[model samples]
Target: MSDRLRVPSSVSAARTGAPFIPRVLSIAGSDPSGGAGIQADLKSISANGGFGMAALTALTAQNTQGVRDVHVPPVSFLRAQLEALAVDIQIDAVKIGMLANEDVIVEVGRWLAEVRPEVVVIDPVMVATSGDRLLDPAAEDALRRLLPLAHLVTPNLRELAVLTGREIGEEWDAALDAAEQLSLDLGTAVLVKGGHLAGAHTPDALVDAARALRQEFPGSRIDTTHTHGTGCSLSSALATRRASGEDWPTAVASARAWLRESLEAADELQVGSGSGPVHHFAGLWARGSVMTRPQAEQLASDWWEIIRPIRDGIDELPFIRALADGTLAHAPFVFYLAQDALYLREYARVLAEAARIAPTSEEQAFWAGSAQGAIAGELELHASWLTPAQGITAETFAAAQAPATTAYLDHLRATAFDGDYAVLIAALLPCFWLYSDLGERLHAGAFGEYARDPEHPYASWLATYADPAFAESTQQAIAFVAQAAASASPEMRERMLRAFTAASQHELAFFAAPLTVAL
Candidate 1:
């Protein structure tokens, strides 16, 4: 996993004051089971921060088991739906899926030529997950003609074989060759999916013949049969990310990451007995109880539990364990103190900004006092550790600042300036809550007896963690953030949860920095 958290492009853009919501259109067939085709497209688009609209080319009687039958509407009605949306709304991107026949393909091609949407992602949905053919074999030529109209075409192994007129091979090299040939012939980028290959890892590549680029995205094959609409969901998410100002590679990477998470959480839905649908809003649903309307304390507890792995990882770090046992070398201990001093400098500023944007007088006063305490109290502790007798000077202290420290401060600063009060406070809470919790445990001899031993080398530092006043401050911070989240809109609450989660992860990274640099 990447150390840096990646906020979606739409959210990042909003932080920069653009606030653009991509208007995405899905021109595809309909699945009554809501697993694939236009249904999956709409869900994927919305989950990726796009406003989704749909124009149906056909309707399918299908479920996770298989496609029972398909009914194509007249080409005229499909054209009417496309024209109506085109005239009324400004489409930022278009996703084409399951064009049932030659006429529907040609109709969508014509509309594309006329409207010229900014980004077009075509998922050549020829076969269902159950190996049922959705497109007529006779329409292959027309579909090939329609390929060049799209910015990118996503094709599974079988569909690539149909497009390239070759026997489908089980080798990854053969797949790449076929993808490159299709890209060359159609003058568009090709996303070659390796789901059909017999392997432990499912790999994907974006081949652009014109640019002479072949970017590979390696992934593990999720051991699940419930990926009913992965292609439709991925293509729609790719289009939405592109429309939100991400480049082709970035958009594909983001969409693939999201799809993997959806697949991981697929079993939670249990929509069908056979192959089931991927949970479209898995990340949002997991972040907070958006559907259940949780109380403030419940939400706070959930957030803490969600970061349990991170907290556990922190406890097992060499730096943390060494410090708790009072066996840490002096240089590394001084290094940690210097980095903490650097972090508290920016952290204090973010706290002040939180106070400025706070809604109530109580919140404002709490944040403001916390900021002052961070500077006046925390920095003083750090200063005593960096004495000249320790051979640490001003220049040495400045040089001790690490990249992990900067990354944590960057997240806090970004949230302070760009995010609302609710999210900013959420981002700020992890520092108080995690440290206080760790301190209280250590003071109570959770790790060892050094924390309570006055003669211990780092007893002063450990004593600070057990401070009753600081524990009270941490509780107040948690209560304020939880109350704010409870009162927020569902969307805003989700954002808060994401901010809190990211901050907790950063805290883990921060604690690992000193030993990482020493090694």
Candidate 2:
């Protein structure tokens, strides 16, 4: 299966010949409220399309409100979960979030000896989203042991400051400098999430790649109390993307988008009396804007530029093509849609949030109505797809999918959080527009032979893609995203452009022509 079809799911109970799935083992503390720590890590990994497993070092009493009590697990017990998962399941990825003390950190680090997963995304969980220190002083030293081995070490501004003992001093350039210094010191891919610091946009930098991506994402600056799990969410998201095979930079981008959306959407939900949490499934219910035909049509014409490499060789890409054509044989798609429905349920609310912070009510209404329509349509679509004789339970879908390609989502997250509105729109376009185009093209043409000569269950699937309105909406979305991305500096514009290009490639792979290496 193509990475585009990837979903993050770890083998919970090991069995022989288990179908391949992205596995992420999280070593961290547990959050009973499911907002931060290991709980947050598991949710983030699973939500971002990975199989999440956990070995908790501590359990904390907390909610959207705050952490009240913490019970540290004996370090030996922490090591056992690590050993058990490592021994049985093939862990594709590992995430370290919220280790309470140095001993526990060292224990997990030592346990790392046996498993040795390919990708390790360390969140460097030093501080909570509420600005409380979660790791003990000793853990910092243990963290150093894994830095050299980590694929990526994500640190927010404060963590960077604490780790490097350098004042990043509110300047974007300074933060980048600090991140670079940390990378040099640790010899690991370092991501400095500048979300908490001051700036018109939250710019994050990935310092390992030869060409560093110092990006600033522009989005609605949400003023909600539910940001308790942002850090855990972001790191887990990055880990999920990384395990799915994206390079570190792309994974960072993916993590950023997922986290930003969660935060942006949190503005609408009322999870607690103090500060509500961001709704994880907001996208399922919300349709902030209608993707139109012009946008879809233009993409249909231009998509070849991005996807022809993958599409013409379509036969080799049976599973992904199915995703594109909505003709995949798996029953999981129904559950996948159910997951998406839960997500879309809040999509409009998030869009409403975007409008609430938007400069105009017109944009607000557009988003609000879009969310309403999206909710209704999404619910119906999921119901129809799931209500059939399909054995598409949520868990079943979780089990069947493979890992995904995330460069596109990363592009969007970078822009959505730091770029202007136009950039956000541009980043989001491929997801909406390209999928529609791919589905339409295949329905009308390729990937249809799988169905018996008499009928095509893939019928309406293609229509959703071919609709001119869907294409048109894509154009407007492009305009919206591009217009907002008009930056003052050439560098800024170039960065945004790079983000767009990278995202375009991410879209292309979904419909990549199946490559035949036949001799």
Candidate 3:
């Protein structure tokens, strides 16, 4: 019989003869609080798509409040743990954190030499988020020696100050200077995080010894006390994603995005009194009563039913009926196309906002591509209708925005400005699902004489919506909304549903407005 491992539905299973799963090993002290050190490292690795293993270097009696005591395992025992893992399993990446003393650091460095992993990310854990010292003062030199062996070193502002022997003030430029110098001295890439700085924006940069800028990730600073293991999470995520074949810049970008999402969901968790840990699996956890992935998938049909009346209203609209029968007047159709072209420009921006705040790299890229497709595909079709006779240039589209158009665009912008990504995506779903459903329905009937006849005036436009590519995009958008809703809180899920229904109503109004206008 073949050996197949049992795993959580949320995690991938490992089969004996199947392709190897990406494995990441964390060598660090343990925190009893389960927030930082090896605990955080393993969580970060797993959440960022890696199977995590650990070699404990020490144990700390700690809580969210502070570290009380520390006990170092014997160097020989630490060596045994590393060697045992090396002999039994293949490690794709290594995250080294909190090597408490000189002997432990030396042992870890020697093991790195022997079983050299492809990706090594060192989080120089000098000071805790609670301002407690984790690394011994005398072991700084040993940690420095190990830096050259690392593919990347991550240091917060305070740690950067200690490593470079320089003062990093309130200005972000000072930290950048120190990070560049540290990278040069250690001959490695350094990630300088600007979270601790006093500002509305948190900016982090990855730079190399040659002063080459790799990636710069910027974010609006979240106001939350639950930042216990942020550095550990980012560094481990970087290692895991890098080992899984992301380039340096892409790994950093994706890791930072994961860390921000964890911060956004930290308030949902209540672990301790003092600075609690960020929720590592925040994006993956089902926040409402839905317990399984299959249950979540069922929400798609449920949501469609909930919005059925709005769908019916759109299908019954006079404007839609006229278009389906090729009886729509030229003037109203031209006016609608101009307004739609205007609508798409702002809609593209809203999608960009969605991409910026999405919880995962896959989601981010999906939204970004959706934004581009809106402009290049849908808007191009709209523009084609207004040219030659309508004299509608890009400037003309901007000026022709109607009251209904402004209302819809403003509502989306307000939701995006509120910065609740789940709600924003929910608001956007109508543009995809409703349009595709209506187009497909219109395509199936005898009434859609225009859609089937090349001689009909609006045939080309109707085909734009019924295209297979547009249908696939609609399915992807629906899947994303359902997935995000499953991972949102009960209250947040309710908010999403409300947003979806309200936007569906807007879609009905969008089509109806053209009939009332005298173009």
Candidate 4:
């Protein structure tokens, strides 16, 4: 769990920040069954902590029983979507699930070459769990064409057999050798999924071609008919991890962990009949696990890179650092707090969602508590820091914002229609830590500058973040969320990540504060 990645504690104090959201693109077919194909890919992408965008290659009339009919889209249309996405939003990573025909695959390959994305995951889909072929006979050639361009290729046993021209065998080493051969020949990492390998538990193997890295993942073999779309889910999850800047092997490892939870819990209830779909939105309430603080530090590195430099110009007062030192100037601090409070109102909803979908009550409680704490804690910090400004009052604070309040209102209106809690939280993350980080830095080595002002508050605010207990608590929360993904079937965990991404992006947007008002 990388809770520390989002909100790290300074060991002596606790820290918080906006959030890290990964973005991904899925180029594949659509499954009307909504279990497999591009549908599953999108769902999996969201579940796995990345925002998912899709370019459809084919459309399938399918159901839990089996895929009925798949209509392949023209290569031109597929290319169009790919170009549009590449030219506009940055496509962090790409997950290619089901390219119905060779032409489609060719177009996808061409797009990849043009875009030159850093991470590409190819899930060779030939046979379904129900033993039906999805790709055309010529699809293999297309897969080979794109394989060298991929960072990783995920193929199930049947597809592995088809790709390697080997029978499904009894030896694990044989499979490893085959996967290794394919990796060597194709020049890309490969993951030979062992879900069908007749075992009490599921085992997935990842071959790291770059360093000849080999790793095995042991996951729960969930017993249920609700196991549709697992491959699409895994590929999307892998892509998300990669887009988040994880190495190829680490991305696959995390993807495998997320897949297990989704599979095991697919039958938690029923989404459809026959082979039902897995639950992809399970990471909102990661049970109370603690994560390493280093991950938080890593994420902050990016945040600081983007915004801190521009902040000093927001106001000449260095209101944040001044307030931390107990300086008497209260006007700006109160305004900042009010804007933040309004923003946190939305954050609470996400925490509520995190609490709601958790498989267990304890995890739910954690989310619930976090929601309350973030909104209230931040509010209290504002008041405490603003209390001493000469003649400053809460009413005065309310009057201070036009830029901040307008920003908050626009965010509110935009998110008003979004019912998902995870999305809301993603949107609100930036408000919490950006200012704090700014304050901490501005006061660095100059804490005594505002010493004469009792109302100015530097040490107190710094003390709050510097608390070891607070930092530990933040880390614990992060770890729990990671565990939620790690312990689940790949699909469910992936969906949760998508939700996480949506929430994170929203936070990014909050700061970007689009003129259009995305709320």
Candidate 5:
């Protein structure tokens, strides 16, 4: 049988053509710290596309460091909270966490039997990440009785051991064996988390023993201490996704991906001195601009810094050093110039395309003029060096086009045709930025002073790039691309950064091509 949740038509139907938002109810304890229990559940439900509701079983005075004390409310009051929502609101899914005693567990189980939410995910929160016990020893049997009421049970290593009445070993395989047995005994799916295991990887598995099915999700362990509410958040997210009609594996996969992203950004919060809370809204805050976006100039500086190694590699290339000191062999120099001529031809077309698709007239004009310069100015310089009398003709230039030259041109062409204006401009910026920077450095005697000497064999060739006008144009290109990136959406900014990095790598390859092929 398929693992997909069969969402009821009432739950799945669109209201007035609006998207159906699952009404996810959290039957868990309250955490004053707002990191775990019902607090984390509500947050995770909302973040995962659900309208959140809570029916508290207990309340805890706790912080990120540890739980100080717990208060269990009257079982009648807990029943009242569950009943009130059941009468007025249709709950699409329920996530249960941290029932402090047998009475609380029994009450929640009775409510589940009556209300019967379409999706039920129970996070057996028996022990805290700080090694504090949340569940009472006497309530363990009651919690076992409640397990069968849930469609899925999320258990950490210790919790799984308690539920299965088996001492689970430290290895992941042992955890899976226990999970399989628990799933068989309880007649429900089990989400066995490997976060507490010893290794570089944290693997989670969904096991359905009746169906003889097991799907393992492998993940790298994030080096973080701020995992205060990971189980609560993940279970709630899974409940929300299942309520939204996702299959078992897909829901687990989606929740795990979101959880990992949250963990990665957890340190940014710094909420407490000990184990901290994950940033529940990291993706939303970034994309919604709640997080500060870097300014254009700062972005340029950051991008330049990010590619320092690539820049250094270009500087160390024999081709660049030899051309700087005018000691480059005739064959390699001619080969390089011929390839540059061919590259300029396609690079000019890409620049023209960038102009055609530019959003603003100023940007359009700048790209158009740069395209003209690529064709007229750069090709003319290449022609001066790659003369037919020197045994380098149009055929010679075409035939000598190295793989690196073709690769660089292909990158530009692909970006120009397939990517957006922001991404295309970012890809184009590296050529201008790297060449001008290298040119200025060579002129200032980075390689040798021969590049500036009038009598140097390649002096005029080197001077073309070092010209103040070219440097000015490079700065202008950088400003335009950075401005475009600054106002872009988070997703667009990432694409731009990737394109810029790839282009920088291509620049290094293009510079190293001549000598690589010659050698």
Candidate 6:
């Protein structure tokens, strides 16, 4: 959501030398069920931000229950489809799935060898989720020969076992070993998926056959039966992300995360009776138009209204009242400032971590500069009271940090380290937003005795938050978070809101803690 990360408008894309869109080609069969094969592939590609194109290999008269019939296209026509697309369009990536026969596989593989698209993801779909054979057994050898052509091949446990000529045990170790073997033999990266394994986690590993680079992506298994097109979706999403300029590991991680969200939201769609398809546009649906304005523009206003009760409660707290009236004792205020200084030290590190993982350079710079600003600007205000005139140090600033302070900082640290980037930004937002809101209100002398007075002791402190520069920074943070929420999946947008609301509640606790301390 950085200024640099702003997506070019479609007009801008057309004017620029860069591609107007990442064009993904799904070279797979048709799924009448709309839950697998090319249907699902196109959905996955579009959901992950790409332009999707498909060349049908075959047609299946199937539903959620199972495949009823199949008709393979003539090999000559199949080659025509591939050639037509290769010659006419710019293909950024290709996802190959469910070739019905050896002739089909050889034809597509020949096109692949000829064109050599920059990114190729082959799903190796041998069997359907309904226990129907998709690829002809005679084509298995042809598929094996085709493996080396792909940049990455995604095979579920059953497919992995077949490809490697090994029995897949229930333990995930078997899949990992088989993936390593397959990668080395084929000279391509292999993503060994363990979604079928009876476990609490859906753990997957990406193994580079030639390089021996292995990265494990661990995610809690989403308890849903509507995972019909998971493999097709994963491979297509991976290809799309790669086409959009993500590294192998990052692309895989992002694809998996998006697929899981789609899985969780799959039940909402009434596409079929058995396992339904994942809702590709769940993000767009959940973030419906907010009045007449765009979702991102409405974010700050929406969140403020959503947490109105919490804000009301905070305004009613004794600590806030006393501070506004200048009736708060000097000792508790000093104690609060010391704990704040301690909190800022840790807060700065979390911001730095955010900067490290930000997808865009502008976002990275914004977060990095914010970290420095926190320590050099806000902490400096606290240091004026806590430190000696000479300088500040750990010994001088250290105090018995309040439990509220510890809890809030721990939540942010956890988000910074483990949560999604959008969620982390949401967690960091309340500190900027709520403080700015309260400071602006106090500066207006709203329910405050000495805020408007020139001689008020904490006037300078309140002024820092109300400063125009600080308000501008807070607005930028809000805009970034809102833009992210607008684009994120429904589940992720909810997570962002939860993080925001939880942090807002903690802000209330942070202020109240000083009132309870014995002066």
Candidate 5's displacement at residue 316, Å, is 64
Q: Show model 1 residue runs off by greater than 4 Å.
A: 1-16, 128-133, 291-519
- The TM-score leader among the candidates is 1
Pairs in steric clash, model 1: none
lDDT of 4 by residue, 1-519 (tens): 111012111111211343656668888888787887778888888877788899898888888887677677778888878888888886667888877777877788877777777677888877766576766667777777777888788988888878889876646677888888887777777889887877676688988555577888777667776878888898899888777656666777787778777776777647666878877665533542334323434433443354444443332344433444565344444444455555555556656666676557876787788778765675566555545453334442553334645555455345434654433433334433444444444345344655433344445655555445555555555555454445545455445455444444444433333222322
- Runs in model 2 with CA error above 4 Å? 1-20, 128-136, 209-220, 284-519
lDDT of 3: 0.83
Q: Please, what is the whole-model Cα lDDT of each candidate in the order they appear?
A: 0.87, 0.62, 0.83, 0.64, 0.87, 0.85
In model 3, the runs with Cα more than 4 Å from the true position are: 1-20, 130-133, 286-519
Candidate achieving higher TM-score, 2 or 5: 5
Tens digits of per-residue lDDT for model 2, 1-519: 012123333332223455445778888888777667777777777777788888887888877677789898787787777778877988888888777787887777776665566677788877665577666666677777766667678888888888888887577688788887877676666778767866456667777533354544444455666777777778888877776666665677677777777787886776666656556556534632233323434433553365555444443555555654445544444434544444444444544445555556666565565556565554455555655454334432232221222333344445656636544444445555556656555555655454322255555544555667666655555555444454224455455555555555654553332221111
Count steric clashes of candidate 6: 0
State the lDDT at 472 in candidate 6.
89
TM-score of 1: 0.58
All candidates in order of TM-score, best leading: 1, 5, 6, 3, 4, 2
Per-prediction backbone clash count? 0, 73, 0, 53, 1, 0
- Least well predicted 10-residue stretch by lDDT in candidate 5: 1-10
- The sequence of per-residue lDDT tens digits that candidate 6 reaches over residues 197-289 is 887987999998576688899889887788787889999999898878777889898888888878888888877777777877776566664
lDDT by residue for model 1 over 176-237, one digit each (tens)?
A: 99999999898888999998889798999999888898999999999888989999999999
TM-scores for all candidates?
Answer: 0.58, 0.50, 0.54, 0.53, 0.56, 0.54
lDDT of 3 by residue, 91-210 (tens): 878899888898988888998888767778899988765566667776888998888888889999988988888989667888888888988788788899998888799899888856
Model 2 clashing-pair count: 73
Ranking of models by lDDT: 1, 5, 6, 3, 4, 2
Query: What is the Å distance of residue 306 in model 2 from its true position?
Result: 46
Candidate 5 lDDT (Cα, whole model)? 0.87
Q: Show pairs that collide, candidate 5.
A: 226-276
